[model samples]
Target: MNEPGYAIRAEQLTKRFGDFIAVNEITFDVKQGEIYGFLGANGAGKTTAIRMLIGLLSPSSGIATVAGFDVYKETENIKRNIGYMSQRFSLYEDLTVKENIRFYGGVYGLSSSEIRDKTDFLLKKLELEHARNMLISSLPLGWKQKLAFSIAVIHDPKIVFLDEPTGGVDPITRRQFWNLIYEASSKGVTVFVTTHYMDESEYCDRVSIMVDGRIAALDTPRGLKRIFHASSMDEVFLKLARPEKVGDI
Candidate 1:
């Protein structure tokens, strides 16, 4: 479990390339064991902000920390304590399910014995025992997503960054995937996720909506709905994303 207070913290976080600012000065705190939804449309800077938080991209200014490690100086340390699952379903299509698990474990510096043990555990936990030796390409999209997420947290990282982890899956699979997320949160893992799905945003403990590289709204789902005088998160998003359409709501 993380210490009391925030598992992730940012202070006036900003990122820029030349004269164009990709991520404006945004600040927020994500508590340990909480599911935080980072919502924004394409080109709204959600990805840039996530890259900075995970230490994939350096910020032009401001300070941030993940799992208690500084983004600038302790990027390696940060990577070791956090897991990542991208929307692209980052799994090798030719590798068998078991092989992929072992490969990721090795990448995280796990011993051979540890990799073997994790492979056994994940297969059972994710109910993939029947397909353990099957090539990833043969699995359905839902299975691939579950396997990708399982591999990401194989080492039990303190925090996990999920970049649109449920893009194209069906409703049933999405619900099942969220159950997995809830299970991880129950075990004290901070889940930082980014998505354009409005219903997905409602599942978060709190959400932040970005507009043109700036956080226009940051609050709990209920709080945001109440503040925006809307009926749902979708309405809140529409209101914030298109302020001129507030009257339409």
Candidate 2:
């Protein structure tokens, strides 16, 4: 049994697609209410690893649990206990802002009364009251991203998984998004996020870097910089993932 303080736990977790091993034996733990950043270049096996952690894809070997439920055996429970947002805002473009909230609330098993209360609260919380009846497609990208994240957590999940959630947003919007993450973390919601933005990695309590399907480094951003003798997460990543670049050296 995993310790009660852990939100995510993996032991020699691995994934293999036939002869191709996508994720080698990787082991790590994320504490309850912690913000953990998962970073990697494209095709570094981050997606495959996240799928296994969130119970979307089964691992060929090893073990993983999310929110205290086995990834393979308790996927439904894991899904229920977690919120997820991808790079593309998952909102329905055709649906009104409030409609989108209600629909997702329903999907998460929120009752009619609960959904109604949440919708009102979300509109005010996200400062979208005036846009509540507006179609999602009509909202600005930043607003849409914020709304998408708010809706994902309508059920008050224990953890939220953000897969490149800040992609394409302006710097100010990205900063606002990080503020939201900080607020969520302060409220005891563990945040598991993946991003290509090296600057974003600095915001995490701890970060794990994947290189060619393996975790080459995992630590606090400052600690990683010290270990790699680099000044920023960007330099650290380049050193770990692509040391051949003369500029990086």
Candidate 3:
């Protein structure tokens, strides 16, 4: 079993590249089944911090763990326990929807029989049974994103990392995508998502905002708004990221 307390825990985590710190010393914890939003602007180091937490990049110092596995010593174990969906949507455009599901299932070490069962369930759930034979490249962007999210958690991973999972989609599609996130969370899957969409941050249970390679604020959306004396996450970000532009908000 993993930790009895948190799905993910980081204490004073820092990542440095040469003399430049991409992720400054930061500390936070994600409880089991929580929807955590890692919010930041383009250069705010959200990706870098997430990379460290996901075991893609090594942290310079501090302590951290994912799914109860030490980040530095048990990365392989961590990898086995988590699913990742990248910003660009982790799907093969050339492959059919069913094919993509099968491939990822295998990569996640599911048996052939398990893959077959999951493929069928996924197709039915996404209402893509009719499109299973169609190439992913032919699908609409919204459908593709929904399918991508479904496949990410096909293996019942303990945690799923979504790096801007709802980018480039219409508001309705984004809302649908969040429904999937909520479904997964209901089943005890911790969701750690990184995105810059201020509107979407409202859907998260809690969010941490990064600014200039450091965590500027971390709180529930309502709590952050209260603390920053702002109306929304965007205004909160403006107050933290660009103090001089605070007047504009």
Please report the TM-score between candidate 1 and the true structure. Answer: 0.96
Worst 10 residues of 1 by lDDT: 1-10
- Candidate 1's residue-wise lDDT over 48-141, tens digit each? 9999988889999998889888999999999999999987779999999999998999999999999999998889998999999999999999
- Cα TM-score per model: 0.96, 0.97, 0.96
TM-score: model 2 vs. ground truth:
0.97
Residue-level lDDT for 154 in candidate 3: 86
Error of 2 at 25 (Å): 1.0
In candidate 3, how many Å is residue 64 off? Answer: 0.8
* Clash pairs detected, candidate 2: none
Q: Residue-wise lDDT of candidate 2 within 1-249, one digit each (tens)?
A: 577999999888899998888999889899999999999999999888988888789998988999999998999999999999976669999999989998999999999999999988888888889998999999999999999998888899999999999889999999988998999999999999999999999999999999988899999999999999999999999999987783644
Model 3 lDDT per residue over 1-249, tens place: 455869999888999999999888889999999999999889888888888878899899999999999888899999999999999767999999889999999999999999999988888888999998899999999999999898889889999999988888999998989999999999999999998889999999999999888888999999999998889888898888889876664
Q: Stretches of candidate 1 above 4 Å error?
A: 1-4
Q: On a 0 to 100 scale, what is the lDDT of residue 218 in model 2? A: 95
* lDDT computed for candidate 3: 0.91
| lDDT of the candidates, in the order given | 0.92, 0.92, 0.91
* Residue 110 C-alpha lDDT in model 3: 95
Alpha-carbon shift of residue 88 in model 1 (angstroms) = 1.6
Count of clashing residue pairs in every prediction: 0, 0, 0
